[model samples]
Target: MHHEAVGRDLSRKVHAAEAAVDHALIEIAALTAALPEARMRAGVSGVTGQSAFDDLAASLSDMTRARARLGGAHRTLAALARRMGLGAVAAGPMDKPDDQPPLDGSGGVTANMVNEM
Candidate 1:
């Protein structure tokens, strides 16, 4: 019963983390769109110059940082799910090729090899 409860809790946490990541992605997209619009408006109004550009750059950098944080949250949630034996459920499908042999040379796997496989 305790294990089941832990599993339920982990599942909830994973869902919450996924939702948070989705929200953050949406926010990042919206901000990415708005930043350009804002810059354009500022340029048209003659109010945005070097300083405005700098501000927009900073905002973009901040958004990138937030997205990284969201990614970390997702990793943490996945770890928690794994601890509860729900990692696969949270991770979704694994379509990785099982027959792809390890790279044998320093040149790295070529595109032709991938295509042939």
Candidate 2:
């Protein structure tokens, strides 16, 4: 029982980390998409210099590195979930209740339900 509790805590941490990574990836992708257009517009308007472009490129590179780190975090979380027998939580979208178990009102939560939350 103690081990199960510990596993639950770890699984929560893993899922939280994975969600953070997923959010970071989304933000990074958005920034990456907008940066080029912003740079191009600035260049066309003569309002930005080569140095500004270089700075934007550097920022994009930093975001790229962040994205990679987030990916690593996601993979690590997935592995931990698998170890905890909660691998299916990370398998894909939870579009159906059949993919999950109904709550028993026992003050205990299942992985699928937690993921949905």
Best by lDDT: 2
lDDT of 2 by residue, 1-117 (tens): 564566566656655765675676576567656766887876665354556656656766776677678667755665565556653444333333433433324635445533556
**Candidate 1 on 1-117: residue-level lDDT in tens?**
676566556656655765676676576567656755776866665354556556656766776677678667755654554455443343222223543422324635433222333
Q: In candidate 1, residue 62 scores what lDDT? A: 74
- Model 1 residue 102 lDDT score: 28
lDDT at 115 for candidate 2?
Answer: 51
TM-score for each predicted model, relative to the true structure:
0.42, 0.43
Clash list (residue pairs), candidate 2? none
What stretches of model 1 exceed 4 Å from their correct place?
Answer: 1-48, 91-117
